[model samples]
Target: MVAEKDANAAKEILQQFEAARTQVGELVTAAEKNNQHFDQLIAADNAAGHAIINQAIMALVAQTGSIERAAGIIGIDNLNPDTADHEF
Candidate 1:
């Protein structure tokens, strides 16, 4: 009877070990999913940043076009004076 009790205790210990290992496995899976989410966020942020830059560039192009059209109507030269000396 004593040997049977010892065997039962060992079996309980083995069960506990398996349970602990299962918990660890679950945690590892969760961590991997979290890492993938982080990577997706980083990629999305980069794409958004590029979109913002593209919008700014488009806005600047529109503004410059307006300036040139206004200058053409007024018959005024819009040349920069800083580089005018190099033309000679």
Candidate 2:
């Protein structure tokens, strides 16, 4: 009868809605995992870059006197010894 058909249609609509919701949840989970993986990759790369930067900083500190002279040679005002007495 019409009542039974209406109930069946309602059930089908409900099932479809649930399927859509589940698919959305799955997609969101996958995206979140991908984002986490990407973040980890970026962090590792940054860590590597950090090591290089640290080594460069140490080398610059080691050659502090030459840095001031090199700065003058390169026309970079920031590297002048008279401007900043600090190693950085």
Candidate 3:
């Protein structure tokens, strides 16, 4: 009778282990899916940041070109900050 009781207990333990393993597998799958979504969001955010940087760089290049052209037209090819007079 004691041996029969021990066998039953062993069977119960095995069932509990199987349930726990199933739960752990589900949790791991959820975590992997969440990680994939997180990676996609990070990639999109990085792409947007790079786009903003590119726009700012283009704007700066255009502004610099405009300033150089204007300076050349006004006969100020090289304005020395140390010796130039600033009165505003």
Candidate 4:
């Protein structure tokens, strides 16, 4: 009878461990999805900012007739949109 009781207790412990592991796995999956969504949003925002900067650079060049002067107004050395770094 004591052996039967111990076996039942062991089974219960095993079930609890499995439940905890499943819960942790679900949490990790959710977190990964959230991170991906956040990354997409950041990328879209960066692209939009890049477009606006290019527009401003073009307008400045048209008005000033000098790309260097436009770049100096924005406090950057080179305003070339194609080669500019967009890291923030």
Per-model CA lDDT versus the true structure: 0.46, 0.47, 0.46, 0.45
Candidate 2 lDDT over 1-88, as tens digits, reads 3224455544544554455555444434534754433244336556643443455444445355444444444456764355355545
Better of 2 and 3 by TM-score: 3
Per residue, candidate 3 scores C-alpha lDDT tens digits across 1-88 of: 3224455544544554455555444434534764433244345556643443444445444444444544454456785433135331
lDDT of 4 by residue, 35-67 (tens): 433244335556643443444444433333333
Q: Using Cα atoms with residue i matched to residue i, what is each candidate's TM-score against the true structure?
A: 0.36, 0.32, 0.37, 0.32
Please give the range of 10 consecutive residues that has the lowest summed lDDT in model 4: 61-70
- Give the C-alpha miss distance for residue 34 in model 2, angstroms: 4.6
Global CA lDDT of candidate 2, please? 0.47
On lDDT, the leading prediction is 2
lDDT of 1 by residue, 1-88 (tens): 3224455544544554455555444434534764433244335556643443444445444444444444444556764434334432
The list of candidate 1 runs beyond 4 A from truth reads 1-45, 78-88
For all candidates, the clash counts are 0, 0, 0, 0
Worst 10 residues of 2 by lDDT: 33-42
In candidate 4, position 44 carries an lDDT of 53
| Candidate 3 vs candidate 4, lDDT winner | 3
